[model samples]
Target chain A: MEIPTQKKIEMLETMLLSRKFSDSLVELCKIQGKIPGMMILSTGQEAVGSGVCAALEPGDVIITNHRSHNHLLSKGADPKELMAEIFCKKTGCNKGKSGTLHLAVPEVNAPCTTTVVGGTLPIAVGRAFAQQYREESAITVCFFGDGAANEGSFHEALNLAALWQLPVIFLCENNLYAGAQRYEEHTRVIDLAKRAGAYGMPGVIVDGNDVQAVYAAARDARQRALEGGGPTLIECKTYRCRGHGETDPQHYQPRDEIKQWQEKCPIPRLSDELVSSRVISSEELKGMESRAEKIVEDAIRFAEESPYPEPHEALEDVYV
Target chain B: MQKLGMGQAVNQALREEMHRDPNVFIAGEGVGVSIHVNPMFPTTGLLEEFGPGRVKDTPVSEAAIAGLAVGAAEAGLRPVVEIMFNPFFTLASDMIVNHAAKLRYLSGGKSSFPLVVRIKSGAGFGAGCQHSHNLEAWAAHCPGLKVVMPSTSADAKGMLKSAIRDDNPVIFIEHMGLYFAPMPVPEEEYLTPLGKADIKRQGSDLTVVTWSGMLGPAMSAAQKLSQEGIEAEIVDLRTLTPLDKETILSSVKKTGRLIVMHEATRTGGFAGEIAAVVMEEGFSYLKAPLRRVTGPDIPVPASPPLERFYIPGEEDLIKAAKEIV
Candidate 1:
């Protein structure tokens, strides 16, 4: 699949924005002198989210795991409300009910993101089931980590999705770790995409750091889904630069491996590719970075200015 | 009015709701197949009537079934999925208890989760401990989910209609023992609103607080107690979570005596919740110590005679009522 210059530039801009958004969160935590509870960042895997989500249209649904800011941003989540949700403010997308770990933006069709490892897989299948049941043309994109593949629901969901020929793309961002447990040690399957064959769906592995590769694979899968062809499992071999959460000190990880993945940070890599290919100049790339930084700054300001929800507000959302 | 079994009434409700709303659909293992071709099974003839799109027969995947309902509910569709039996509910609890029950609250009430998880429960048919446990208390304890258990055919039809239309996740538990028993059901459309307790029988001597399978035994015990001039008021708590505390406390206030009854075992049964509610709100109204007529805290035995011995029966309800009276 040949990538268009405009789409390439758009992907670069999304990756830069997502990276800045994540960086702002870390900076905010530093200023607060504490990491907010249950905040998981997708630092080095920005390209996978940007690529896959860029392939999705407006009506497509997205279900992701705890490391979800990049996916939400790539799907066009309002950064202000997302940041406010992290700040536990009333203006947040979930009205302070779901913090960073369980953020959901319904307007962007990214409803009900979970922190549970394999929790989003089945839900994604159901979403696709609804789309097919209604005879709608749209599809669902489910994003999970390498650890989630080991969950029984992963097998169950893939089987059901394939059996029913539901319109869903199972995107596994293989970040090499399932919350401090190395993927290789946790599961015998080194290549998670190979497991998709057990369910009879096309399984493709892509260079997660290469935004173009991830985007092309997701676009083809989406096309197949729209054509009534069953679900596809696309495994993006990616890596997370930081500890599972902000608290870990990286005792379990090998320093050299972490250094290697960090060196391939997708944001700068995509920017360099766009510049070297003459699709965009170095000055233009610099301008995009500053623009992304400004948006992050504005989002932080909005989140900081938002008011905390009242104590009674906690009881309001327990039911319909 | 027509005499219909609980399963037939549930079928009527599902058929009516599915016809009324295009967004409504039902899915389960063998839902569309003929294994449960008995008329008493709710999904009988549903696939033929509604077609495969709405009546989905899934593989033996309970987690996916529950998650399918949760996801479909979030995506502007009302999915009424089945979890086969109560024990299989454990396999699906991560989705039911954790995801389906908590998603609405986690979304800050912005998302309306309109789905019904229908599971067959109770300690009859000698289905062993795995299949016959009444775990309504487990679902009733969850905050964002509504728990409903209908004892009569009328209630089965009426409450299911309300559950399907309600803008929340509802755990609709059907008693396996009650499925075959025919009861009066109105031909006209009617709904039994959730969170309201029905007075199965009105009397002043004592209040029999019960729900689901125990309602049958409690009513039988109520009939037996009337011979001795003890008029027992049976409070059937149709919905457990949005518990009809009003009716329970009112019955307790009137009778000044209460006996909580359930087929579930004594330990951590829903009876404890009713007993505590009465103790907290209507303690002064009590003339005698409140009693709990419940099964022993053990797995429901597989043997028919042993299971009969394990389940709380009319004898137990009568004994408890007599003691409280």
Candidate 2:
């Protein structure tokens, strides 16, 4: 599908920025051992996070899983603060308490992930219920993997959201494989969107690699939610170029599958389009990539120079 | 003067609180109606009076119910959640641990988790292992949760009322053994503070620290000891979290011997904490070493014969009292 000029230009910029950031994180992983073990990268799925978050307001709440660094960045979290959190510096989003996957910045209304599978969905339902109770038109969007659909909490939350008519958008980033297991192997129901249909809400499937597509689906669902149209389920079919985390060998993914998705690399597809459309040239695209590299370097420098927290600081945020 | 059980006292408290606060309401698995009726039956006639929205029967999803209550409590409503059994608490732990307990602290003390979770506990009446467990220690260990276990009819009524009005997450643990047990309770507006102990009997020989169903047997043991001229002080700790250390310490000082008792397993029970407190505060006054007469370390068996020996009763209390003094 031919995308619009403005959409393509912005798309390439955001996706390339995500790719650059994650790539730099792997390098940081090499130098400082920052990411504890395996770090899941939205290298290919960056388009989905960037596009959906772009349509959200500051008041709207978004929650997701441990694979959530891109979501926070797209939701307007300061990169330096995010880097500080990962580095365990005092300047971090959770004051250095939370790392890459569990970042919560109150300013953007994006909270930390629950870390466990299928945890955030029910919590999102509660938040939406709270919003509705206050008679506010705010909508809550929950991001989870297709594996989460198999969890009871996923069903409980969706059922409650539908029953209460709570404003929540269940965004399933179906990256084809939940770790090593492919989606079709475990789930009898091939389509997760159809699971939403079982709850009496519309389930839409979209090209998660396409920023315009993800944004269109997200914005429409958000409007429907804000208008008290209950909950909608959007299954974004994407791919995980990176393993579950930085630690995974990614031996489970087939070579052909990886090659196929790499060809549709969200960053390059839109970048080439922006370059050809004259919205941006190949030189500017290269310049932007270099700029992203330097930005990441500065973040690393800031994080490395920042002092580690006091030992007692461990107990400070345990409750709060 | 009125004589009623703690469960009746709780029913009285509900009747009174519903009259007092329009925002106060009860909801849970069977608060309104059930196929087998509520085993706890704490919400009889409440659904009719308050409507399903207030005194509603939720689906068999404790997490959703608790989450719904947390949402309501956050948005200016007082909700009382009835978890049918203490074992069922696992389903609501997310709401309890993640949200309700941490909301006040997370919001920088700006908000209050004004939610009450009433759970049925104790293992004396043959409810099987899962249905019968005294898990109050879990709540006592939590930072923001206020754990209250009332032993008398009056205290149950007063404490439940206090819990409904208090701006904190309160777990009102009701002992199944004492639901029908009778005591004198006033039919008037009253509130027992969240963290205070009541001295059941005056004595000079020994101090008995206990709560929940154990309080009755402790009082009976104290009375029997009193008849023999060996005075035993009975201190009932109505609340477990902000434990009534002051009352416990004073009673220990007066009697010079402390014996803590509870129906929960002894390994990590709340009564163990009381023994620690007595040792910390009244170490010099002890006539003998502090002792804890508690349930053994085993899952509550379903057999009533084995269960009787498991839960501390009058005989167990008498044996402990005589052993100390």
Candidate 3:
């Protein structure tokens, strides 16, 4: 379960990159309103995406939910194209069709992101089923929020995945709140992983803010899935620091709760871990931050320079 | 040529396609069971031939079935999924309308969702309102979906094959009434292309455009109208979306009149779409106002006598055609 020092640094770097991407979006949104559509920022939950996606191979599939920019970045989706997509440019990953919420990067095996809660759970199972049918070693990882667990799709997907022993990892990023509704208010079951036992699958809970812990759990789940051990539900106890959307009001969440979660931010926590462990110096961590910032800046510039899709382009891509 | 029931033709199409491509698999309730043992199911004998891996029987989870199909299709497999009844399709509409239909477009053509959803529709065998509804209009209204309804054995075989090969998601509708009806089907390989209409019976007096379960009634009405000196041409719109507007307009140009018919309810039916097309493009060609012979705007009745009244029949088409002619 122990990750190498170099790998740990890389994880920290990926988390920083994801954070910088979201940070750039927030800044751009404030300055010029450059985003063509609504933004679903994955600010506080970068480790869940970084850790889970880091466990996946090149061919492994991951179906993500609406707040999936971090998942896409961690899965190695081109930041420039993703930024262009948010800018509604022709050079974007989805050719300006799918904005932030519905971004897809098939090159990285993340084909689709559903805006509907828990919608992609069964889809991930299906992909795993196909791989199992073909006897491929690839697995499918599904990322959803704690709120999505209440959806019928989540239960059905788990049941089928277990019944067929499909190679799928049902990774629940338990961000505590489902669009401002706290987990306690939404469901009686406080531990989402416990529900996985009902479906006859291993339920493992991980520290969502700890990159190494999340990565170890995801790695084990992926291994189990690929070996025909059926699906595993890995619940990462995380938090979404920002409001649901860019313009979401702060009336639902208390300020104290936000401050507490913000203090436990995955990026700084992992950076501190790396520094305290003497795996990297404080200066090295600062260098990684600047590198991530530069990447985000380059991506923003690329998006700004990209041309908008022609009016007639809207009629295209409806079919083959 | 071989005489086969519509259901048998559908089974044949699936068998041939599965045999031809290793990537094609079918999943649905009762599909894994032998159809000969269970006469009510269309996926007879597929399980025995294809084995459990290719022929899967899932729990009654429509949403999961649809989502699985989209996922499998995107992951490099051609999945043909079945919803036991048309009404049950509503449960899966989120996946069908939002995922399967929009994935290709949302991916900017990076993904091809070659998924086929087959549902049995229409009323006649006392299946009641829930099991006997035609929602082809609902499917055709979606821009990214191709809706196809086969009325005959040949069309059922041909269109199903074409739908499996299609790159986009196709909503393949089979009528409950036509399941046992026998018609001649060619043994040789053939495909009825999507977005094409078939001229069932040609005439010059008036054009009667219809499809699916209504084709038989429309043809019968056309036959009766011919005896009355109104030789009504029957245009079966095999594919609803990407409609064969050219054939419909050309038929109207020749006949100088149009009567659109369908088993779905009259209001907001696909007939209205066809009517609009004819009105917009063939306005000058119309010798009479566009007429429609469709089921009344109410849920299909459970009782046979009331159902008979609810469903548009040969007499209804004949009346509509007479009004236009």
- Chain A TM-scores of all predicted models: 0.97, 0.93, 0.97
Instruction: Please give, for residues B65-111, the per-residue lDDT of candidate 2 as tens digits.
Output: 77666655655578787888998888878777776776444433334
DockQ of 3: 0.84
Residue-by-residue lDDT tens digits, candidate 3, A1-320: 56877778778888999999998888787655577677789898999999988888888999998999999999999999999998888999999899777899999999989888989898997888889989998999999999899999987889888989899999999988898788899999879999988999999999999888999999998888777798999999988788888888858888998899999998888888779888889898888889998998998899999999999999999998
Between candidates 1 and 2, which one is better according to DockQ? 1
Predicted complexes: DockQ each: 0.83, 0.21, 0.84
Residues B215-295 of candidate 3 have per-residue lDDT tens digits of 998888877888889898899999999899999999999999899889999899999999999999989998888898899
Question: In candidate 1, what are the lDDT values of residues B173-287, reduced to their tens digit?
Answer: 9997888888999999888899999999999999998888888888988999999999999998889989888999989899999998888888888889888988898899999
Candidate 2 — which residues are off by over 4 angstroms?
A1-17, A32-40, A271-302, A317-320, B1-26, B34-41, B69-79, B94-115, B141-144, B153-169, B177-198, B242-250, B276-285, B301-307
| Interface RMSD for candidate 1 relative to the native interface | 0.8
Q: Is the docking of candidate 1 incorrect, acceptable, medium or high quality?
A: high
Using Cα atoms with residue i matched to residue i, what is each candidate's TM-score against the true structure?
A: 0.99, 0.85, 0.98
lDDT of 3: 0.89
**Which model is ahead, 1 or 2, in terms of lDDT?**
1
Q: What share of the true interface contacts does each candidate keep?
A: 0.73, 0.15, 0.74
RMSD to native for every prediction? 1.1, 4.0, 1.2
